[model samples]
Structure formats: C-alpha cells, structure tokens
Target: MAKKVLLRVYGMTCDDCVAHVKNGLEKIGKNVDVSLDGNAVLDIDNDFDPYKIPSLDVFNGRYKAQVKEIKDD
Candidate 1:
C-alpha cells in the first residue's frame, strides 16, 4: 500500500540545497514518489532504505514527518 507523508526540512538556504534534497530522495528508488516546495513529501509504498541516503545532517535542518494525503493509483 502507498501512503503520502510530509517532511519539514530546514537549512535549505539555496536552490542547490533543494536539488541536493531531490537527488537524495530520488536515489532511494524508482518505486517511491517525492516532492519538495520547502519541505518534502514522500509517498511511500513500503519501508524505505535509510542507508541509501547520506546523512541529511549535512543539510543542517529539522526533519519532521506526518501522514498528509493518500491517493489511489
């Protein structure tokens, strides 16, 4: 089952920061869905791999998550 999650990220001081976040999320897998405005949303289908991502602490920001919305597709 797929679910939508909202992530609040801080320290995105520039567009490159956004790109870095996007690249990090995309590297997780093609099966996952994600987006970023200021924060990021992960529409998860299954448990995700944490190892695939480098430490986000590099971004120096807050990361918070919650279920936001769900869509059937």
Candidate 2:
C-alpha cells in the first residue's frame, strides 16, 4: 500500500517555490506533486509516516512546508 501525504504549505508565491518544495520532498518520498496554491501531495511507502517527517524549508529557507493531512491509498 501507498500513502498520500497532503501538505498545506505557506510562503510559496511562485513557480520556483513549487520546484523547491518538490525537490525537497523527492528525497523523502518516491513521488512528489506540488501546487502553486500552497499545497503538496507526496506518495510514499505505506510503512513511512508523513507526520514524522521534518519541516521543509527549501530554496535557502524562503519557504516552509507543513503537513495538513494524511491519507492511506
């Protein structure tokens, strides 16, 4: 099984921010999808818990990511 981690991010205002978040999350999950509207969805192994992940501050700390919801899929 795979788990979808929906993150409600903040301080992301452009395409660069989206890229930053995606790159950072890619290290933690197998697949990462980021939206410019302050949201990110990560597809990780079911054994991994999104809540245990650390805060994301990509692009020289210009933005921060927060986990908003977790779902099993």
The top-ranked prediction according to TM-score is 2
For model 1, name the residue pairs that clash: none
Estimate the lDDT of model 2: 0.76
The runs of at least 3 residues in candidate 2 whose Cα sits more than 4 Å from the true structure, single-residue gaps closed, are: 54-60
Query: What is the C-alpha lDDT profile of model 2 across 1-73, one tens digit per residue?
Result: 3888888777788898788778888877866889999878888887777776545436347776677888888
lDDT minimum window of 10 residues, candidate 2? 51-60
lDDT of each: 0.48, 0.76
By lDDT, the best candidate is 2
In model 1, which runs have C-alpha deviations exceeding 4 angstroms?
Answer: 29-37, 49-73
